[model samples]
Target chain A: MLLSGDPPRGRILSAMLATIVAVLAVAPFLFPSTRALAVAERIAILIVLTASYDMLLGYTGIVSFAHTMFFGMGAYGVAIALTRFGAGWGQVVIGALAGMLLAIVVAAIVGLLSLRVRAIFFAMITLAVASFAQILASTMRDWTGGEDGLTFEVPKTLTSAFRLGGGYNGNLVTYYLIFTVAAVLFLFLLRVVNSPMGRVLQAIRENEFRAEALGLRTLWYRTLAGAIAAAAASLAGSLLALQLRYTGPDATLSFSLMVDILLIVVIGGMGTLYGAIVGATIMTMAQYYLQPAMGGLANAFSGVPLMQAVLDPDRWLLWLGLLFIAIVYFFPTGIVGRLRTP
Target chain B: MSEVLLELRGVETRVGRYQILHGVDFAARRGRVTMLLGRNGAGKTTTLRTIMGLWRAGAGSITFAGRRIEALGTPEIARLGIAYVPETMGIFSQLTVRENLLLATGRDGLASDRLDRLFALFPALRERYSVPAGVLSGGQKQMLAIGRAIIEPRSLLVVDEPTKGLAPHVIEVLIEVFRRLKQSETTILLVEQNFRMAVSVGDDVAVMDDGRIVHAGSMADLAADEALQHRLLGLSLAVHQ
Candidate 1:
């Protein structure tokens, strides 16, 4: 922030970054192939989830363990809005925004309750709140569809309305629309991160008392940051529903989801925006491909083939837990931290 | 010869479970340096802090520039032309010299000139504007602190201790800077324990002992009074170490 000697150039760099994203987004439809469309849709989903996590964990210093509550709420909000009302994508977007707004309101009240409590107490409150959210979701089974979850006819016309080589591209149009919104959001967040408001946040992280002494209404500013973080997670909820055509506490929001986000931000570097993307990519790759790939190596080492069976998808949790320990111990600064130091 | 700028009437302060200042009555004149001289534990620092509203003033009031400002916050007190250089310097360590200056925003319209004047006063700051302030030497950091605050709308600059552990040359430069600051229409409240250095720059001096103003008079009177110095500071010229 200091060496740049100019603040306006950040916006320009963000614009350039956005242009690259736009170009990468178009490359999937070079042939309109089904194989390419599936990959694109997956990336779109990941972007929304990761971006929301970044806004909360990176920008704000809350380091929450209950953010997925808002994400789940947003999904349910949209699902209910669409299922009962037969509303279009506009209502879903509004529903998501409403979820975000609701999260903001919740965060404000929660922040007040937790303001005086530093570190451990704050983290504990969030954890309890998230568990409560999941329980509440199941209790409202009449509206939320209980444990079985809710399903709806995917709003085909909204996606098809766009001229992505005209009619019925199935998931391709939906992926493109979500991808575009995510891209815009990414740019918008970048603008916010480099603004005057962002600098004050950084200042707060370095020394909150000093920032408070400077006549900054520290409580209000912190609560506002929390609200913004919740809003981002809520948007992620909306995108999750649209992509999967389903909404449930299990899928849209859960304790594990918040844990995954914590892992992502820790891997990415807590304060940087790009760290979220990096962390998500690292985590997703580990889950999607690493475990199976390790099976061949395990066979060579053990010759018993027990490694693959024992280290299947479920055991990844143990590995993730150990990875977190390693992160806190050996790489306390996270991935981006060491690079930014010099 | 300057007009009165600060009047502390029966000011009292309590920090934590202890009352650190008691009925400390003193006044600083505009465009002149007033030193708060005392031994290490004689509440020299607490007096400066109470003036800036760092600690709550339990009783009495402080009138700065003809306004009662005892109840104001630190930033509010600072905004009213009273720049404080805390004993710790309060230098934003992560920020560069330029960024520290940027954060010390004066009145909305008069900030630009103050920035320019500060750069002109300290040429080294201009050279190392982009470097983080944490990297600067003790003297340079002190200079930056003084430079950052000694600008527009600042009539009183409260310096806790500029030469606490500085070498002789650095101490000389700080004194020169303080002398220069005094000439530029800025009243200064200097708190120091080194009697020689304290008495030289300050036009008026107040000696504090255990939370009370034990003596208050012209700098010349306190500097020349050897009997009082020996009684208060346990220093005798004949048995000087």
Candidate 2:
């Protein structure tokens, strides 16, 4: 498959992706309103977040649920840095690194304890650890601002060119900043996934026993992969705090983030990077369009109770739930996997 | 007289507290094909697993090239110049045949020359070099597995059942590959239950019963001693017209 060129399928996909990204990148300049740019910005962040998780779930086959701890930490780190210390872009990046460090430490403890267990047990352990982090964040009311949350000033230096930090600019600057950061991380993920390390990881996922027998350090590789995922999540978290200009227990350590990321990975595909983008786009758009779309459908199907439930704009989540179930049930490989591989 | 490259002294292994290998003493020497013969559940593969450090040696010492390797992990063991071709073939099925070979052939001497020789030995592999090994024939897969082991700077090539489920022609092809490996002065340890083929390429053989070696001697010696062989192998060596 790697060397095959039976058709122009790859070129077609690449062109399609390039066109979509071009439209996304250029839309803010042409649009009268910045809402579409905001959507793109949020979608780009979700792509990084989901792609990071897919590294383990899709490629490495080490499902982790506690990486949200890193994301939350990253969000809190940059939020606190920008609000308290009046930090700049460099400081925000440093704060993001701190979030990554926090993630690494947590992953180490988790990795050490759970390295021996495979599959579901690993997933449960990571989930438990993440929950613990969330609970701790909520308990620290003074630092995290609990459910109500804390306001943060956008870093004056990062907002310098657009004059956004002084509270004067539009969403365009923020979206571009988020887009650039997410793009860097996305490219980084691409590089890492295609590297030698990635090959070993994919090999480990395929057959761990053979990997161990071949002399690869299975535990270390797994831990490293987990750490990379954590780092990626932290970056997304930092961006989340940046975009909102705030952090709270509700926003920083939300379970919704985890659920949405899961949906993104599942809907897109597990093993491939492009799946993150596919998954994220559908997930982000569901919230934006599902309500309006469902409202229109509900008016058309008044007599049907189940269709009412499915099309209730207030219960758009039900539609999402159905789609998710359908995807997992019908296509075990995922959307990208189903479309791409023979 | 052949040089003994490896020696196992009462090697025992356990998987989740259930003992698989209970004190197996075995040896494979230089420039000779040592065949480990046993029934399916007789711990033949387990013995190979322990020797390669896939499973930890609960009790025993395995010395490879005069160095104690029982404590080492499999990768460390492989780095010590021992290559294992497992029963599952250990072919990275998702990767192309060439990628699989490259990963296994890590820094081994005369690599290009060895690769050329291996490709020559298995032309089917060369033809399907870019294809995933998952699609290859069982015999071709077996040949690829052996060829992978041979491409390395091999001190010992421990193969777990190279002839498992191959056609007569495929087995014949594998035997030729094994013969070529022998000519390269590489020591080969084969795990086999196929009586005829096992006896053919094998210089020495160990009959394993219930995780222990019941008999170990030169193949010719066992071929001549019908009564002793029948007692250990539970098979008659005599040909019937």
Candidate 3:
């Protein structure tokens, strides 16, 4: 029921999903290192963020370059609230709510104003809007802390110093909080994509003209999808801010983050919500470990200058890009798509 | 006499710089099949698009069930009980055959009886119900398109070139399907290049030339007279056969 009757078909894909979920569930205990826990936390947050992006780009066929803008709204909302009102549960709740509300309103306005245009034009509009939001965040030094960004305290319960009995600590609590929320949000997205309304979204995505002829007011549905995606992305941002205890344009509103989300969506699979979990896990782990692995490889190839240079840790991004290209070439429909196909 | 279910008077439509429909006038009588016949580039498709409000009529009025609909948006016009099947067939290729019809139902879920009736009409759809529509053959896709239109009991059905590019037997199947629909008194506006199919299923006929209706009469009169057909369509039903 959580999946709304849409199951992750294929034994390989099902096994992979189960393994990822299981690993994340007990990640802190399995890999107790601070860096490892951090990687796990990042994966959790990215799952929610990428899945929200999938709601727009994959399901609704909306290509928005401003997803990071909504994400930034949430991060900045929490950061500013904590800085101004001081850290508390009440401030966190209020900030997150405000950010989601703003994201929804802005997303709706953008959708209504520009969604009637062709896809490319709408994408450009979102890009411009996102750039403007980034600039606004950077220029507003008084409230936003400017380009320097902001770091603030969370509730005492989430801090590392607060430890429970039997070696349990607030870090574990924070991780669990994020993990639980991500799981709930992920299921929520799955439910939405498999619902009757989600079917209409897919129909519109496939052919807008036919959908309208079917008596569906497509613009309204598109706007609703955009608003909902923004709300979810906003929540994801809030989680990120809570986990890192910091918020900045580069962290939440960066164009690079948007590109990362896009890559994950494509690599995992478009239009498949389950793809988000797979994509985020793979991508985040690679981002954390690939460079180190490349360094090890580079050291092994040190005897050969060309091989060493090619395998240098700094060139991890090049390898990542090549890997992405390979995945796309081999699995054009994406990993999940390839797996789902009979 | 059956009343006009849909009427277009001086409905002019422009696509960017080119005017596709110029003062087009025609009517689809209730409980009858109105065949819109034309050669290529005669604005047959454009007229159908205008009727469905896919294209805004730049001038004149389009009345459906005595309501002026030229100003309405496509969805609003569609909500008024008109189902349009475009020449492209407009099948949502990514969706399963069942999902495609499910979307058209506009309900929470598909009614079993309606689906059963659809399966009876197009048994291939039932066999491939769970398969993506993209993989279906051309004829099956056409059947799916018509099936989607009639999935629910719509008041008027507008279809464009249902027999285009299909084989003889497939065309025969479609003709039979339309005849069955005709017996049910479902008002239909059909566009076709195949005169034989038009002659077999059409009740009222409207012929378009250079973006305007050049002839409007009963299909029997047009079918019975070859000279009139040659003058209007540049070919007779016998020649097409």
Candidate 4:
């Protein structure tokens, strides 16, 4: 039982978590770099997305490839509202709510369609649905802006690089906003997983037939988890659109983005909530800094053709592939899970 | 004897293309331990599954508390006050024993008095209450599974092979536990391969073979007649005794 797990260890974990949050809050002042803040914001948004995904894959034991579909819905929700409705901050809230509702409906439909099948078939169904959604986004040029995507202005206060008085200005406000949202969403997810309902989710994950024998309506619980996860993912999607002031299929709905989420979950530890945040930080930092750093190494090894090719910035995926291999080989339980084991 | 708590009349079940239960008729009277005994592939498990609505009955009917439940889902059947301990001992291995028991109960969770009673019956579970069930020994895991079933009071309890692969001492403990539970008000339908334990615990007996009940009678009748046991079970009860 979560209530009975090592109390001292739990205390240490909470302390560690508090330290991490404090450091993140003061990071902007400590670094004072725009590029750093941008990277941190990106990680913040992804933390919400991946944590939501964990609710399905980790807690509920449902491997879904259509997570990006909900994320895209959130982004497009805000994008469409601003571009066509000439929406303000109030409309932003309306867009998020609409996106969440849409996500619940779509997730329920998809879950009903695919839940009849087993794991691999469910994954395939979600993939097919995600691809179809991507195509729909591309073809519906009228609403989605098609392949070119949509760029729109947010409220002047949010977009202004520098405001004179107490109004928010520059990267600091956006970064803090992103951080606050991510933190709140992460805590919400944590609360859900710790609750008695969450315990049922884990029980279903471990053995659905058994859970049912205990009188749990497993399908309904799993469906509820899907709706909750989808809603949170859409929230992240909306934040991403706000952060970039742009929306596109490739950016939001791509299967590659889902794969990135999978990588973050696996590398950080699939079921652990905070692992998502830790993973987002590690992976985003790698993406931002790995290529250029590897480029410098590539030049150093230019004399050796093979070494230079392997170290090339364009081939940074090779290094990432190796990193993935190393993580799986050494830490199969995941970083956070491994920390908890001892 | 009390009225029939569960009655399966002419029940037939098909899993995919193959039919597993063929018009099987069975009943568990109130406050009695009805043992369904058979060799492997005898459809004993299927009969229990049909009663639980894990497999839909293609024909005939299963009546629980005077209501037809042949068309209900597994959860619906479970909600009708039946607790099942599957053959695999269906403990959530990743969860702690206490969590497994907690999930068995809903919002209020296990009452302290009820928990203390269960702990007294199986003290090993109390010691390993916080440990993940996967780490618990096999006997302890079996205890946890049975503990989960009794976490909430139910009208009927169904168990499949509760003592399978257990040590003699552990089996002895379980046999006593079942005896004590039989003293309680709940009706029990048990599927078991070990005839010794069956003879000890069961009040009524049904011998199944190839998806049908070949013989049904009082456990006293079955136990007293070694010739009948030899003819049906391919081993005399005297030999094991």
Candidate 5:
């Protein structure tokens, strides 16, 4: 067979994935906390975004810095449609399509512009593009709500945080919606990576010139990967806008948001699809919980001045930076890569 | 054997302001091994790359199977049934040997009969089909690279420095394989520094220097005339052996 013949291992991994999905589907009822449900939904959205980044960085061997711009497009698309046109399901769908279309067009343009440049130069160009996008978002306040962002009313049926029936609450409904969309997109990407085409992407990642010599249209494939990734990241941004009911330049188009994605991919290990999910969940949860937990512990041990300084939630990023360095030092392959290593 | 399969007519190529190939004329005859021998920095590799369309020809033309391919992209040139194995062997170290071969064949993949033939040619590859190509020994990696290139039928096979860093036994094995390949319809254009190995398999030979072809003739003629070889290559083929 052309494939390496790892059917048994594939089967076991799929089974494990099914079980994880099953648990996540019922997690709202099991956890019974609105905040917990919120965090889980956020994780789901971030997972989709992070996984999309992996398509470029991991599979296609491209490093892009404009990922969050597309994500911001998604958020803006949904928010602008909801607030200006009204909350009809049809309008939301159109807005999502608009956002995704923008992402694809931008990605294609960027792909074309950077095609002839070296890898590091391409990254710099994307960084410049992302900066330009953020500036545009902030300045074009008429449509995007500028610095304050757009906040719109949702359809009451979806805002059911208090509705009671069939174990479905507003939080649960929102969670399930985000979770389902994320799951479908994630699975689609998984299938894409496992196919024959995925093999070509991986080949390009390993050696672009060799792949080219072997008769592969490396540029077309790289462009395709970038477009797909941008679309998915946009969708994730739309979900984030819905979840927060806010679409601001800071939340969507900021450099920090892009760095967050980079960190998630790096921590999860690039190339492995599941690593994106694992890394998103771990990073999101750490940001959500670790800072406060450390802050509380530091307060309890206030006698030690250094403990308070290092453990302050305001200084949480410093701790995360140190953690990132440690991960790079000890687990260079990342969490999934390290775990898989013999 | 006299029929020209791939022809380069006054092809010029530049890489970042440096002209690597200076108006070169080269050809590979059908069903024959054409050895391209050159010293370091003689633009032998550049000649192969220009044919493959990896480096765009600044001027002139390349014709494969009677169609101009100099202006085409790399994939289009490859799709015209020309396979290239570079000096690096170009094996994807992370992928298993099977995957590498599959990628070479594109969507159709290797057929049973073709795979069987490949296994016969390189038995070590069959033994480690599922192992990552990175772990293969240097000789085995060369075999894998050649196997990937010949996984499907092609009009011409261009190989650069195939015997570089290879041991004597490995070179002998490659020579035998090439000899068998030459008997088939495929035209072979090989670039090599090893005079002995090149002379063993080559039917037609071309010697290159200073970004241009200095000499072209039958391999037997070049092998027999030590004085001519000494004048052209600075060393005779017999001396290297």
Candidate 6:
């Protein structure tokens, strides 16, 4: 019912998703360490971020590099609001709203101007816009904190100093808050893709010409998709800001983060909201754990020079790349797609 | 004669440097099937695209239901009770047959009576209602394309090469489907290469050559005179049959 009639279809897929959600729900108790909590929080945030990107890339069949720019907008909105107006619930609300508004405006403008062009061209235009946003964030120094980024305090209730009774601290409360928001946003996205409007978006994705001939204004729908995706990304960014209490071009506006989002969507499966959850969890876990696991493996192989070198932690990225290639080769439709096929 | 429901007057369309439809003038009467027949590169597809506003007319006018629609967008033109099925079939292979039909309707849900009529015409669509359209055979895809066009009531239906690459039996079925549509009083403008299928369903005919309408008259006249058919189409329809 929460999926709005579009259920995750396969037995394996349903179990995998359920396991991931269950683990995240009890993550604070199951993994208690700060690093573990951080990884879980990142997974929650990335699920929202990647699912939002899927709205454009998977569902709408449009590639946009400017997703991070909107995300950075959200981060900076919260960062700047807390920095200028001071930390409070009201400030968080104002900053999040401002960020979403800005993202929607920019997304509308970019979509209207560039969506009429061919796909590759629109992608290039977004890439250029994203690069420009990055440069602007770096140069704005005073307000944006330039390349160094902005670090500020969250509301007292969300900070680590505020401790509830029963061994629960503010950090735990914050994690749950992020987790809850992510779940709601993800469900909202699922509902959207299942709706009649979502059907039109997929129709446009499959065949724009046919969709137009069918009397749907494809440009209007595409722009709406972009704006909705942007707003969602902004909210995700705001969540990231709340968790880290920091905003930076490197963290939110980096091109690498954009690439990470793309890889997550592909690994989970394109065009399915459930893919976002699966993809983001796998991708974020790998980012946090792969290096440490590789380090331990290298230590165990210390007796063999060649084996140790190959298992070096610094080469985690290479291994990650190889893993991605293997996934693509084996499950060309992506994990969810392959699971659903049979 | 039924009043003209759709008309193209001296419509000119240029695709880059090449002029595809040069002063194409034709009309589809209310409740009649107007077959636009031509050789390869005779601009039959271009004429259909122009009528649907997919391609803008460089110099001319398109009037549908007594309104100038040459300047309108494709969505606007379609919203005016005109449905177009391109030569590609445009089936949206990623979506299920039910979703494909649902997209064609203006309302939230498909009308059961209209859906029953569609299922009656193309039972394969009913059987594969929930399956993705990409799995359907060529003939079934063509059937889905036509079924999508008539999912809702429209004053005019424009389709390009519905029988292309279809089996002989499939063509017979399509001919029957067109006859049923004709009985329902839906105007159809069909661009077809199969002379047999054209003559079977077409009530009116327009012959295009070199981006122009070389001949226009009743389908009976074109079918009755082998000499005129040879003169315009460079072949006799009877010989093809």
Candidate 5: misplaced stretches above 4 Å? A1-23, A302-310
* Model 6: number of backbone collisions: 0
Per-residue C-alpha lDDT of model 4 across residues A151-177, encoded as one tens digit per residue: 998866566555635533656666777
Compose the digit string of candidate 2's lDDT tens values, residues B63-95.
999999998877789878788899878887877
The residue-level lDDT of candidate 4 at B212 comes to 91
What DockQ do you compute for every candidate structure? Answer: 0.30, 0.53, 0.84, 0.80, 0.77, 0.80
Per-residue lDDT over B98-197 for candidate 5, one digit per residue giving the tens place of the 0 to 100 score: 9999998887367999999899889999998988999999999999999999999988899999889999999999988998898775689999888888
The deviation in Å at residue A336 for candidate 4 is 1.6
lDDT per residue as tens, model 3, A70-163: 9999888888888899989999999999999999999999999999999999999999999999999999999998898889999989987898
C-alpha-based local distance difference test score of model 3: 0.92
Two-way lDDT contest, 1 vs 3, winner: 3
Give the CA lDDT, 0 to 100, for residue A83 in model 3.
84
Candidate 2 local lDDT, A132-205, one digit each (tens): 88888878777777766667777554343556444435466777778888878977886677666777777788
Candidate 5 C-alpha lDDT tens digits along A213-271: 99999888888889999999999998998888889999999998889999889888788
Ranking by TM-score: 6, 3, 4, 5, 2, 1
* Root-mean-square deviation (CA) per prediction: 4.7, 3.5, 1.3, 2.5, 2.9, 1.2
lDDT of 6 at B23: 95
Which run of 10 residues does model 6 chain A get worst, by summed lDDT? A333-342
True-structure lDDT of candidate 6:
0.93
> What's the CA error at residue A54 for candidate 1, in Å?
5.7
- lDDT (Cα atoms) of all candidates against the true structure: 0.71, 0.79, 0.92, 0.87, 0.86, 0.93
Scanning candidate 1 chain A in windows of ten residues, the lowest lDDT window is A1-10
Better-scoring candidate (DockQ), 1 or 3: 3
| Candidate 2 - chain A - TM | 0.87
Model 4 C-alpha RMSD to native = 2.5
Count clashing residue pairs per candidate.
Answer: 0, 2, 0, 0, 2, 0
